[model samples]
Target: MGSGDLNLLKSWNPKLVKNREKVWIKEQELLKENEILKQKQLEITKERELDSLVDPHHKHKNSKKNGLEWMYSDPTHNEDYLLGKKSLDSSVISKNNLKNDSKVDSKIDSEQTKKFDYSNDDPMSKFKIAKKRHIIQTKEKISKPTSPL
Candidate 1:
């Protein structure tokens, strides 16, 4: 259609333009709300991290009813229970735990070169075996395998 015809059509359909404007306004509002929620989440996470640093077992203390319940219950928790776990660590472990232990350890090492501090309540720090294996592998790799006769 001609530019003039298009202009005429637009002039005719003021309601359509208003609807689009309304939709755009709603979308902008939603985006702002989402940003606000994200900021709140970040603040909450930072607070939790601070609390954890001060009291290493803050989560455990609050969640568990008693010492026996905490001990007897399965130490392992599902991904849902472990907040911020997935977000922090991007490395994926192989399905065969026994066979891929070394590989996963290496991956973890390459991903995180710095030694894990026990005081830092890192979600990935739960895998003590992986860190131990990585440390052993790192030492082994450094020393020359050939022995002089």
Candidate 2:
């Protein structure tokens, strides 16, 4: 190649290299920003989960503080128990209440009598009490049963 052509090639090579570096740097910056955004979203999700666990009254406060409008807007997350809707909160409360009441009743029964027959003939009553009794029996079995191994 000629001297002028060689010079031109050398100049163009550095420019091309600089342009490629700039593009790579911009791409890396974009990737970093995307990763940061994803991390922020994950942190927000974790915070919401932790908040839900720690504060059971968060949903109740949302309705009471923000009014029915906000609750209606986000029924899946907020005011889910308003009449016709079947809310997760309601199910959780019912299950917890059933557990607590059964525990209290069993404690009372144990104080009165040594042996308690938990069997009931009524299907609905049996279904309602079965889980609580199963839990109690499992706990007793764990505490009293001798290991074979």
Candidate 3:
């Protein structure tokens, strides 16, 4: 009825203002929860990457599609056949259990393919260039015989 009471009533909404502080606190709590979930997701992704490097076969096993689709696809599923992976047999340092982390050796045989690319390894690129130069020189000599020299 007084001017002071009228001022308070005009500025206040019983439905919204009464729960405004509670809503703000809830929002802060949810933000913290979301951040924790994001951190967990990052950790999971890192772990999965490490697992993939250890064993490329196990890499896709934990995928979202593994749940129902995999179960129905092959009833007599051998894990190794399911993901066609052989043991590393060389390079990869297996820190995880060998049973869990299969080795990955991607050796490119010279006869098995076109150009034997030295994996673009910088250290070996110099040797590859030298070998190529030698081959070119030999061909040049053969094409234009250099008088028994």
What lDDT would each prediction earn against the true structure? 0.65, 0.70, 0.62
Local error of candidate 2 at residue 8 (angstroms): 7.5
Candidate 3 on 69-141: residue-level lDDT in tens? 5443323324453477755423332433442323221222322454556566686887898899999999988
- Give the residue spans of candidate 3 off by over 4 A: 2-18, 60-149
lDDT of 2 by residue, 1-149 (tens): 55564644664464467767988899999999999999999998998799689878776653343346543331242334555576566778787677767777876776577444545667888887988899999999999969799
The runs of at least 3 residues in candidate 1 whose Cα sits more than 4 Å from the true structure, single-residue gaps closed, are: 1-15, 63-149
Candidate 1 vs. true structure, TM-score: 0.32
Ranking by lDDT: 2, 1, 3
**Candidate 2: where is the Cα deviation over 4 Å?**
1-15, 63-149
Q: In candidate 3, where is summed lDDT lowest over 10 consecutive residues?
A: 102-111
lDDT of 3: 0.62
lDDT per residue (tens digit) for residues 1-149 in model 1:
55554543664464577767888899999999999999999998997788689878657644533447655432343354266555322233233344356566776776475455655466576577678889999998888586789
- Top-lDDT candidate index: 2
Name the better of 1 and 2 by lDDT. Answer: 2
The true-versus-predicted C-alpha distance at residue 118 of model 1, in Å, is 35
TM-score list, all predictions: 0.32, 0.33, 0.32
